[model samples]
Target: MTTSPESSGGATQSHKPACPTAEMGRWPASWEQEMQSTVNYLWHTDDLLGQGATASVYKARNKKSGELVAVKVFNTASYLRPREVQVREFEVLRKLNHQNIIKLFAVEEMGGSRQKVLVMEYCASGSLMSVLEGPENAFGLPEDEFLVVLRCVVAGMNHLRENGIVHRDIKPGNIMRLVGEEGQSIYKLTDFGAARELDDDEKFVSVYGTEEYLHPDMYERAVLRKPQQKAFGVAVDLWSIGVTLYHAATGSLPFVPFGGPRRNKEIMYRITTEKPAGAIAGTQRLENGPLEWSYTLPVTCQLSMGLQSQLVPILANILEVEQAKCWGFDQFFAETSDILQRVVVHVFSLPQAVVHHVYIHAHNTIAIFLEAVYKQTNVAPQHQEYLFEGHLCVLEPSLSAQHIAHTTASSPLTLFSMVSETPKGLAFRDPALDIPKFVPKVDLQADYNTAKGVLGAGYQALRLAQALLAGQELMLRGLHWFVFSNMAGVTEIQELKRAAELRSKLRTLAEVLSRCSRNITETKMTLSNLSSELMKNRDQVHEDRSIQQIQCCLDKMYLIYKQFKKSRMRPGLGYNEEQIHKLDKVNFSHLAKRLLQVFQEERVQKYQASLVTHGKRMRVVHETRNHLRLVGCSVAACNTEAQGAQESLSKILDWLSHQLLQDRTKGAQASPPPTAPYPSPALKDLVLHMQELCKEMKVLASDLQDNNRVIEGLSRVPSAPDI
Candidate 1:
């Protein structure tokens, strides 16, 4: 169903990678003749996949399943290769079965020639080398894509290790990317032409690999051809892996001497072999330039510093030429796997102005992370306050990294020093409470006839009230200043006077409200009595009318009773007296009902005219009583607040006076006050409480004013007697 680029001969050309194991070229002359001789159709070649010096791979379709597969057709030159080398590639492919290893379908022969061709899986995305050749990846792959490359390569190599196979050639070209079922990129190892079975300690003398990715010893033997006697082990594959990773990460070889890797072989050898202890991995120099060596990853690397830290050590271990120093496959696999297992968490310390990006396991505890922060920022463990995602992170010893939803450079874990100064809270306190002693006292008794006198009283009262509230805040601020500072200063005397002045004003207000509440209560009682008298008068009239009606009904009923008795005695004498008596009783009952209905109608008509006036009087009385209760409560609260403020100020004044006397007696001189602008934790808490209290007081004061207005309104309402 998929097609490649079409050519003039009706055949298409598959994607050719930058460093493909095979290249594109014309097929052998007898290939066409051999294919046409078969009577039964097998597969038809639609495009040239790749061709090399020995063999050409073609994009072929199976006639039976209509599936596309890669067919490797060995030519005359490839036939000269050892029979065992040819057989090994097929045997290795057939034996491996992993998601990261390319799958092999079957082997088939040409029609009449009996020449064999290998059928393999077709990769649509081409080789990893093709991806590196992309313009966007010129500076190396992006971090997320690079992680994918690392994971895939490690998986494929791990599979090879498990199968006891040394790839010999482990580079980008040999890794192919296929589009998986879920649209994910899956990188698979392909073209294991140089692969052979080797164990951890086993040694092999034959050399095979791409030059740039080959080990130093292998390079010395294969390219330099001046090797004495050094057998290659499985560690050679790790060297090639390091080179491949470096290329995938930086988009260039780690070591480039003089002209280039290929042009100056002697220099490349010198650069790798002449290092003091081991091979210097990121060493490069331009033509006729000084050498540039980097022990760490360059700043231009796309990977984060946290990732680079983990990856560099692994590279250093693998890139060493000394066999004794190079890490074994087990150690190498573990280090690379560790990088994939953990996540990068960045922490920013507010006081220290430092950022620490560390690779932490998801299961590591918060205590462990805090220790790391202490190491980086030099802040003590007890002083650190960690916040994540704008919320305080509780320093529970068992809280793990996985509990955090996410952390990155843009939204890192913010750390605050608990002992650090809080300037904002202190600044707020200064404007309200820090009054100078030289300021003139308010003249409250001054005449208010003048405009200036009237404004000054109000302004002074406002300032005094604000200062009182600020003085209250010192209860919490005392935690800091009280512990270490002198108490008997001029500022303390002013604060004492301010508290006394505010308390006196509150007491006077309380007395005024108490008097107002009493007047309203008396007025309400008078109205209630008048309402009771009016109700009593109306009920007396109703009772008199009911008594008179009842008298008339009794008289009528007595007459009917006599008639019935006479009828029972003289049943034979004249006119049916029993029936007559019954009829008269029914008529009397109807008449009594009509008379009561008339009384009820008269009562309703009598009160209808006065309903609105009486209702207004009663409502006024009800509202006045409710306001009186509220005013009574407000008076009590105001008195309590005044008393508490007076006692607190008195206690503070006495303590400071005592301290002053003691200081004079001991001949101890006062030191200047501390100049720190920062507020203590207690001060910050006091500020918040003071703000909320001020808002509540404002609302209460407004309610008290409304209650006063309602009391005044009650006086204008018509008296119950007048209504």
Candidate 2:
């Protein structure tokens, strides 16, 4: 039943022409004749636009609607079985509606000529191949443009596969974009002449398209003309995509071999033997170098293992001389999905920082962060206190990264922290006159001044805490080296050294604190007497006499208050009565001098702090004067004295409150067995006057309360409250 194939320009075999040419002004006979005869038909040919081997395309204007279109006129005379080719192309084009696939407008059979014409949406920017081969982009496609084209082409091919069609020919020449220069890379699949439908078995075997872009297995099957050769699915187009990508990036094909009379054989041999090669600028050899010889080193070494593995199935199949292994679209998409998944956050240790980059995941927790910190610095978990905005982090093992970020606001947050290990003792530990680390060699006042900063036993606990933290930072530099080297356990030994040093500082700090406690006790009793005497003076009812005596007492108390502020005693120069009572023993000898010096100050800070404290309290008393006037104390002189006395009282109360915060525990070691010095009579006399004044004020306040009640009774009914 098979008859002789119709003659195709005296050629019986199917052949690929070199890229079909388009001479701008040359109107071929077939197009010129069709335009002449179809003057009233839908589309009229304008000029020769582009010509492929089997079709000469023309930019045409629709006669009825004036719509511009591309009219692709098939050259039936140049192809055997042209009808079958036309039908397959028409069916495929009509079924596709994807944005990345060229749109078919209409199909027309020209009169008096055995020619079929396709009217398609005109693409002003001709083809992808032209853009890459153009002068400005001679190096290769730009990265962004390449990605756009790649994604668009894959989408188009996927669309075709979904409809059970296979585009056997996929190349830059067949991919084109519309007129806009902005989207020159928004390529669409065109010219489905070589395309065919997949049978119900979902497979296709065809010898079609340009040879260089062909999958080697497909080429081999076509060449051998074997009936039993395996049929491949839609992967042939994906192979073409890989080839297109390679050529676009490097401006050259990967599998070129020596050409001869046995050119086909040489190409096949090289395709099988040669590995793909190209360099992505600045790509370094990874710890594991490139893949084995069977696979090509890709142009980009930075691609994820997912994408790199995808390249194996993609290019590796194209490298096959026999059947090429490939993945379906679903598998391809699965590999590319994780391209954006992995993100990292860098953690650094404090002071001697060791930056360690770790993957940020929903499962990342503080415990994991602590482990990383421990590896960098030998600071133990107990010593690490991570804080942000004065609030300590709840370092729960189960708290996750996102959970922390929810509490904190954003990523890459750095927690400012420090190590605090030493415990400040509250009381004397021993009666021995020797501080653990102290020497009795001090003879000069200048030596004592030097002691104030670091050598002083009073600040030794603070110094030890500072030293331990500083040493921890220094020890971190060797922590990693020690772990991997013969010097292992060095960090532990250094930590032990810090612990021993702390014991000495603990004894000294305790001794200083104990002496401080005794000083506070003696100072408190003096203040109590001064308070009592001042109150008595205020209550005397002899206005000028009582006010003058109270002011005099206040001046002495003011001197002590100013001295504490000037010396920067955050907890002041006193301790709480309860805390002092809890101590086993107090060292009274050091209190007369060492304790007094604890509240002494440098000249400049002393002046500035005293002046500022005086000014601030003065303002507070000035505010009180307005209230004083409200209570019928309208006399200006009375206002000034009352305001001054109120300010002095406030200053003393502030000092007592600050002292409550100082550590005065009884574990202190006695630095020296020095005798307690009794208070000066001048200070005791000032205290006695204040105590007597307090008794007088209490009596006056009681009388005033009784007088107010009687006056209120005279003005109001018995049921009313006293004013």
Candidate 3:
């Protein structure tokens, strides 16, 4: 219905991408069926996203993982009538899995509803067109940032082309970006609603593209025909890409604003017959062709000539009046990729033969190249300063990219280095360069000791020349200590020897352990048994036992033990043993009785006192158990309260269910007045079925039947059958 700085260029012969033969109505393999159920349950109310003539979108989150998603809902009555729903985007995006393309997660049909829903990946950052023109972005993007947007756009467009899909609308609104977990911004192509699949046939004609970004052929040839049989190919998308880039790079559209009666005619005239009216000032690149639109490039007064040269050509191809040689992302890449790759630079150092053909990536920063120089020249990074044509290297700018477009191969760039006069600097200097004269002292013993002390870590910081020159003459005529170590080999040997010695010690220890192991197992088992018995007895004995009970138990124990002792001192042993017994003046039975009486009275009184403490502890435990039971009851009450809260979604879902069940078979086709519950039709059917089962449950109780011949809670429907 509206224009988007609409446009296209001339046609070029290339292989048209083939349409995937798969049908579009089904969900892609990436969708999880189980998630579909959760999605329906948790997505109670949808956050309205936007509305358009064809469909409305809403934001919803997965209840389980809380992952955000977008759902596109088709109009119910209109959907069921003529067009049903175009699931083209589902089919297209299902087949697509590119980082720059919006992902389609699932396809959903609500119960008895004519509307279909498409669940898609969510992009929090809205449309690029909005950001550029809306209040959020007070000013347009900077050139460097705009270039990033361009790269992502081209990548997305190229993906579409390769897949044999044309995103008929290539304006900024169609492009949106998502910020990743690592704070990386990724732009994605959305609203495949306007996209159409391409076949092997070279000519493709559609009148559905937005007016703002209409290709020239669509207006001049297609609009001119009787039925508007506009014939074009993927080149149409390329032209729109140009217009988008122009709008993105420059803060405004190229075509002049038009209104009143013949708006389309005025816009078409400006697109075909005339050049762009720069809302924002721009410089023209006149190298490509006489067509001013092709030469319509960004104002690059502050930009590098190389960048301009690379960009101007591609812009020329994209906006070319003739579709022939139209630049898609392929031509764009070919033009820009070269300057980003290998760069040729001449190196000039004072007092050394200058070298030509120094090759490095143009995209590399001066910092990175300097590091490489550090490796080769032995000059530290901090000490190295590079000069590019007398200017300090900055911006670490991309080299082989469009920057080289304006540059000629004949005027090769020269890189000059001014290294500080340190030891590392001397290493980078030509060996023939003069040095201050001094005697080189050689102390092999001291050097070897130092190397041994620190090289246990297996690192050596010695120059190759110094290592060899330590014992030999004719080395550097200077005095400087170069750290050298033999620990690399010594360290390896020490590790191996130590590992072997440990292994031998372990073997010897094992042999000694085996010799000492014979009685240990038996002793340990005996000790373990004794300890278990002692613990069991101690746990059973209550310090709270009554003193009288304890005394009775002790008396019984004494009687049993006394009889055993009496049996050992039997009368048969009187003659020989009686004399010895008499010699054992102590009365064993008497002594045991005296000791029991003395300790029992004192210890039993103390033990009985401890019983009062235990009784109090038992009372506390009993109270805690009672309190825990109450907490359990409280949790059950909370569950009932939560159930009450669940009624919130009931009214919403009930209304949705009513609309969904409405027979649209004979109704007038119009936009459905309201939306259904966010769940899929399958889930709704499940909930309804479960409800029906709940009503029929009283059949399990025979006595609960009603006198009216109805099964108590299983109240029959009034004239309708339960489904």
lDDT of each: 0.56, 0.43, 0.43
Candidate 3 on 1-723: residue-level lDDT in tens?
A: 224231111001113221121232333343434222222412322245555556666665554455667767666533543341276766887877888888888887654554577778777776677556531121235444666676677677767777878777777777776778988667788777667778435676555555556676675643434355547777777777777776766545555333321344544544443544322112222322233343534331222233444455666667654665555556666665553455544333211111223344756665665555454444455544333332333323333332322222222222222332211111121111111111123223332222222221111111112212221110110000000001111111222222222223224223322322233334334434433433343343333233344344334433433333443444344456545433322232243334334333433333333233323322332333233234234333333433333343355456655655553422335544457324457756865864453333322111111111221111111111111
| lDDT: worst 10-residue window of model 1 | 1-10
True-vs-predicted CA distance for residue 381, candidate 1, Å: 5.9
Candidate 3 lDDT for residue 32: 32
lDDT per residue (tens digit) for residues 1-723 in model 1: 001121110112354321111123433564443332122223334356555555666666565454566677667866777899878888888889998888888877776577667778877677777777643354466677888889999999999999999988787777778878998888888777678898888999988777788888988988888856989999999988888888888666888887678888877876666554433364555676655666666543556555776788888888888889889999998988988898877765544333456677888997776776676566778777555554445567678867755776545665655444321110111111211121122121111112122222222223222322232222112111211111111112122222233333345554544344344334534544554554554444434343345345435544543444344444243346435544554554454444334333433233332233333433443344454445445544554554455555556555655654564544434442455333344645554555554554444454454443443332221211211
Identify the candidate with maximal lDDT: 1
Which residue runs of candidate 3 sit more than 4 Å off their true CA positions?
1-46, 76-85, 134-139, 199-201, 220-227, 257-265, 273-306, 336-723
Please, what is the TM-score per model?
A: 0.53, 0.41, 0.40
lDDT string, candidate 2, 1-723, tens digits: 001111010011112221112323444565555353233233334355566667676666565455556777777653566567658888989889998898887888667674777778776666777665542243345444655666777778778878888887777777876545553456788878778888434776556765556665665655444355667666677666666766665454545444321354444434433444322111112322332233433332222232333344555444333333345566555543332242344333332222233333456686775665555445565545333222234466667666443321111222222342221211121111112221233222322222222122222222222223222222222221211211111111222222222223224223322322233233334334433432443233223232233233334423432332233423322446324322311222232123223222221223234334323322332232222222222122222433454456456545543443221211123332244233345645555555554444343334333333332222111221111
Q: Which stretches of candidate 2 lie over 4 Å from their true place?
A: 1-47, 179-185, 199-201, 221-232, 258-265, 273-324, 336-723
lDDT of 2: 0.43
Order of models, best TM-score first: 1, 2, 3
Q: Residue 255 of candidate 1: its Cα lDDT?
A: 81
What C-alpha lDDT, on a 0 to 100 scale, does residue 334 get in candidate 1? 93
Measured with C-alpha atoms, the lDDT of residue 560 in candidate 1 is 46
Clashes of each: 1, 26, 25
* Model 1 regions lying over 4 Å from their true place: 1-46, 276-280, 288-290, 346-357, 371-388, 395-397, 407-723
